[model samples]
Target: MAGSLGPGSGWTAAVRRLLRQFSSAQRPGSPGFQGLPLLVEGQQVGLVVPAVARELRAFPNVFVEVTGGLELRGGHCPEERTEAVAGVLAQLRAEGRLARLARWRDEAYEVRPSFGAPALLNVERAAAPLLGVLQFGAHLNAFVCRQDDETGSWQIFMWLARRSPHKATYPGLLDNLAAGGISAGLGVKETMVKESWEEARVPPKLAAQAQPVGCLSFTYEEMDGEEFGAVVRECLFIFDLEVPEDFTPQVGDGEAQEFYLWPLNKVREAVNSGSFKPNCALVVVDFLFRHGLLHPDHEPLYPELMAVMHQTL
Candidate 1:
């Protein structure tokens, strides 16, 4: 697989240019800033630092960027309900003690029942479902891969599990062209195709040609646990696949969100100290460190976490 990738085989500058504009601007929530919640439809939550709130009072929720844009931030992603969100936020600020913008991050939550039913609560104090069936988990681990005379970055494709969409993530499959190589660099075997066609509208060719990598996780809790106080084992999976460096996700995947790669240093630091998606710190960071992604300079920064992974994983 490494040999097939020759000179000038990677992400285009256009892709880098697009990701930089946003990745550069948005750091995770500041540790010093307290999160204030703005009420949403039925009290759903979003976060804003005080400085962010003050700045927000001035502009609309979305905007255009110097490069890749159509920005929806400060309590809004384009996928979110726009006017409803704005109204709820306005009302929350007016009624409740101005919340420190609660964010609906995919991690860090409490499980308990108030009215005798299981529910998941984020730090923002909003509720969502639990006890669900998900297809699988996918992994994205960035690495600094280099060839002589050409030192560059590569997010290596790792692995994936089989299930189905009509049933689970990938239904009865293994040894596809996408992942077999990295794990053992063999080649295509009996494998499944991409769900892009089923979910978003990406071309089948794209999915077929697209390699599956590490885990893209789907995790949830059972509401019964909150009411019954039962212990559920934490669940997770690791998917490994590959994609063209310049590939842009089609709208088929339920994920309307965007991803931009940052410098390895910046991503490592933010994932360590900042309030990023909790799973990242929980899973990705440990994997990267165990795999030698962090620099010597960074190891000292998160010595305890580093040490833990070094010992555990």
Candidate 2:
């Protein structure tokens, strides 16, 4: 029987009693089933439970409920099941394993479901609004990689992307690499690399190592007040490109600026002087410096870059 730790609430107690009833219904010698985790789509909720195949399938968030039970992995259960399972979840939530306990809000969308296509589009449009203005839309990144002669560090060239000059990126809500403003959005390393390839015609083989090292969010609300420059807003999703030393950047159309391995300090100076957009620059540079690839003596390449970084907040 699916019993829980400590006593349960009203809903939980009811379900526990029902489980006790159901367990009694099962044949005693029947082979035991393991529990599995459940993942709810509409909301970021999950729960784990052990039961026969059919019992867990009734869950709303379950995409592919296994035949045999799993080790109660994640997500919430059906409202019908919630009343019964809440006790187990409540106990787990208190222990910090299941913090985002929630009820299913929208079932219709759940019925059909989205493959997170919106997140992909939001990221592309957010990075480069007029990206579609061209025959092809590409969110560009210039990765500069070098093989250290002494240390033999063979890694990424430049994991930085140019600050998009396109004024108004459509999906204005995506503040960083994650929490996007659209109804749904993309949030992972490989996805960003694909976006770069799609937008810039970067050959797939070249972009193979595009990894998501980190995310830096730059928000512009300066347009909230009067007029003129105060009316522009944008969000840039930062991505890291790690490629072999021989890999050269492939630029499509009029997308990338001077493509080369500029010293980190020089890139920093450009950012500080406002010669470069601070969103990708600050985020990428800070990440590179933190990795020890940067020599400690490297000074502030762009002092004003700090201002740009701060102003975004």
Candidate 3:
């Protein structure tokens, strides 16, 4: 794998370009792109673009425009703040103010100053990006290992899921073995187990074997066809689950249409071909780096790739 991924590899440019796509959030002081900080209880939690801010201004009792940013207004407690913001979001959805709100999940995501901090509030999953709040999720890289008879070495095969065509976002795109948002009140492992079962029929006991790996984070702008848009800041908690050679994942909740156990090379090819969902491609790149498929000695942009994938959010 390392040999195939050297400096002159044809896929190098594609992989580099994909990483840049997710890390494309405009930096502070960039001309023509400015996002107002969304604060809660005096703590900055998200960034609201001008258009959304204007829409939010309609609900003065809920959204407060301050000197340089916007603030969520209500009682200090998380529940109160959540209720206050949720009502406004639901109203906006009903009015068709933002296009992305059409895919409301009714699921809540904890808004925090930072990961592991006490929750500032719980906002609907669809509203997290709109509010520019930090969103957390778990992704599992399920693989099987087998002994290569001729080379007398081990080989890895990864399981890739084709998302259901009926999905609201990224329908029919390739995804990690199982991935899901860390909804309010659920820990990383718990979400992993739930997603593993829902997207693929990995049993609780098998899913429990997943090992907690590092994370990938990025802040990118997502715009609707109209003026409404979002600054999406996201962190994905990654996990690796090694399954038995004979274990075949069955579709559990229809989130995934089917699964494929592809060799590591094939997985890399798919990632380079832009077949995997954007973020999932980053996860796979991280996987390759961890498993020695991508190495600094061979890949010219190794250091930059590593830094960009783990950007601070």
Candidate 4:
């Protein structure tokens, strides 16, 4: 049946559409286009939109408008840069200049020119979009496999979590079993384990069994509201964990309200219906591709989809 995916397959269309939304920010002259390259230590580390740039201009000593773009004042080391930026962010928050900063988690995300580069500075997680800095996160796909007694075929079931309604973003949307942003001092695997335990009650021993898969990257622009024009450049590290069939995920930290174990087809349907949070849906799609549920022969845009998921941002 997996071989039947070919031209005109409806299943692949939804996945294609979702991927397009994430890639929209990359389009030439798209709305809320990154206003200027944000440079730190002579290297482009992020982007600054005009609104953010205007607010930044007020802090002349900390932020300077250079020939090509915006740059942090010179002679400041990474620690100094972080302190200067924190002061500016705190002032802005106090004055209510940037509305998004109100959601501050008091958590810091390291700013780097690239994924593995040394930290240029550390910024509040909520302010990442405003700065257009690349953010990193870890997502775990927890699943269990069972054999059909009669058909002798293996079926995979994934655990999906429904976000708590009171959440600040994507409230009540379906999400991966457990996921979280990598805080300034934590490693990728450590964050994954912490989030799994905090959000889904997944024991550390079991979470440690998760195997590291590849990653997905995308640049997304806020379309409207207070954060309009703010960009989110993110890379999510994906992990696959096979849980025992009897294991049931419990609500650990109130982030997730409930958990459901559904077959791959049902999960795909939710993705098509847009029930899953946008980024979580992408993670699930990557999982399906890796597990052989999605094939190139059936999906015409297979190559493009694969490429877009790993955009060189």
Candidate 5:
């Protein structure tokens, strides 16, 4: 597939831009004060400033004492703090303070001090608007891709899932075969398997065969509401699964509308056509590179693109 796609193609540029935006080396040059310090167990996690954080401080469910930075304490343990924040977000949703933001999964994800190892605390996925403002390192994405060599020419096809129209964010967008956030109390592989079953109806046996490819990290400022917004720092754990040629993915959950198996050219077209979610588009580009479907000589900026994509989080 090397040199099959010409350099300077619009899709190639789009893919390159996606890779650059998500890389830490291309960090946004913003004033430091835009984000508030997020502290868990007295340690800094991220910076957030969603209105919900102010509400969190005002709510009595969780102890919010501000000594140097905003801290989630007064709860006996991390669970307590998590419960307190979830409750607060739920109430805000009910009161209409948070509208579409509430449509995210209700599950909680573990927020770590940095990348891996020890976890600091857990928070609701929807409440990420609040935490995202703090730029907490809790947000994570697990992407599952299926590789098919049915063409018998060593050609590859990837299975893609279309998001449900009812989804709050990126509704009806194309996504990976199975993708989800790494919820609190769930490991990367665990979340991948769970999402695989829920989103693609993949049998546990099949899901278990998935292998971790690598991780992509990026931080972007996002507006959660008209009045509230936060800088979001996220890491996506990418995985690849080799599947039988005849295998088809069914939607077990309402999260996705349907699944489609697309060839490399079609995948590239869909990604550059703006049919896929921004993050998913990036994942697809990474997929192309890892699978050797996209070659270094295909693009003039190949070296720069690969360098940014391969940078360690």
Candidate 6:
């Protein structure tokens, strides 16, 4: 979710407005670097820069070589570049410059020059908190939805999780039933299966039944103290898991406080009312449209909304 907080009304109306706004637009406003160059050995290999890291250019040690965009130079190869960047981040952390940054995990995410290709380098996930801030590449999202048959027929209901207050990012906000970043070592399905258990406590037999339902790609910028103007270029690997009617999600690892089974109408109300995290709302919109709940006759911006949902990163 980007730059949304508190509560608002007109859930459905808000959805319409967002559809019209994002679909009609191509890029975010000038807040942070659109695509900062990630240079290695004076050659442009990739892109990565914070949307709003105030001291990006004032690093005391790591050299900033500017050409067309903010360039990180000095490392002889990709691995060397990564070490150099990590060193800078370690220094920042030591100086208390990353209070708002997520807890340092010493984990690395692969930075690719393009989609579905070999990575140019591996960078600390904390350094490029925003997906495209360092323009590393794609982060995966898993959206969990279920079928509601309480009305006698198979109707749709969403299982939404309330993020734990302890979370460093978007704590206590609404989130998908089971979601996480696709870490460097995990494959897509492996990630989905792991999160299903770790976040929602879905049993293996039930989790194995989960199905892939395509993906939603989008880029968003947020205004926050830690990551101002951060751009997230993400591809959500949406999944649909039909749990037994009586199943209730229990918090497995404290990522979520609890889970709620929401009727489709209530889901719509929450979305319009801004009760859901911003990006989660986008996932819900795609689910609704895919299930034929959002139609052209009712939503004048239906086509545009769909277009934005499937935009190429």
List, residue by residue over 111-154, the lDDT tens digit for candidate 5.
66776547666776666645752222211122324434664344
Candidate 2 lDDT over residue span 1-313, tens digit each:
1111222133233323322321221121336422232323432222223322233344334235444322223334444333333444344334543212222122111111122222111112221111110011112345555666877755443433342344233222111121112222233444455555543455666555555443333322221123211111233344445455564444443234324555454443444344433343345445544455433344322343333333321
Candidate 4 C-alpha lDDT tens digits along 211-271: 9998999886774365546878999999999999889999999999999999888888888
Top model number, TM-score: 3
Q: With candidate 3 superimposed using the best TM-score fit, by how many Å does residue 79's alpha carbon deviate from the native? A: 1.5
What C-alpha lDDT values do all the predictions have? 0.31, 0.33, 0.88, 0.87, 0.67, 0.63
Q: For model 4, what is the C-alpha lDDT against the true structure?
A: 0.87
lDDT of 5 at 11: 78
What would the TM-scores of all predictions be?
0.32, 0.38, 0.96, 0.93, 0.81, 0.79
- Which portions of model 1 miss their true places by more than 4 Å? 1-232, 273-275, 295-313
Q: Regarding lDDT, does 2 or 3 come out ahead? A: 3
Task: Give Cα distance to truth, residue 253, candidate 1, Å.
Answer: 4.4
By TM-score, highest first, what's the ranking?
3, 4, 5, 6, 2, 1
Best by lDDT: 3
- Checking candidate 5 for backbone clashes, the offending pairs are 47-134, 47-135, 48-133, 48-134, 49-133, 108-184, 109-184, 133-230
Query: Model 5: C-alpha RMSD to truth?
Result: 4.5
Candidate 1's TM-score? 0.32
Off by over 4 Å in 6: 1-9, 16-35, 40-66, 98-103, 130-153, 226-228
Candidate 5 regions with alpha-carbon error over 4 angstroms: 1-4, 16-33, 50-68, 133-153, 303-313
- lDDT tens readout by residue for model 1, 76-178: 4222434333454455445532332232222323222221222222222121221111111222332323333454434444221222223222233221112
- Select the stronger candidate by lDDT from 3 and 6: 3
Q: What is the lDDT of residue 257 in candidate 1?
A: 27
Residue 282, model 6: Cα distance from true site in angstroms:
1.1
lDDT of 6 by residue, 1-313 (tens): 1111223356447867666544432253445435565454454444444443236566624557465555565376778866877776777678876553556767677666445766656766655543253232211223334434564445566788898998877788888888766667677777777888898888767776777788877655444474543445666777777677778889999989998887677777877877776777787887777677776666665676777777765
> Candidate 4: where are CA atoms >4 Å away?
1-13, 27-34, 224-227
Question: CA lDDT of 267 in candidate 1?
Answer: 44
Q: What is the alpha-carbon lDDT of model 6 when measured against the actual structure? A: 0.63
Q: What is candidate 3's CA lDDT for residue 290?
A: 91
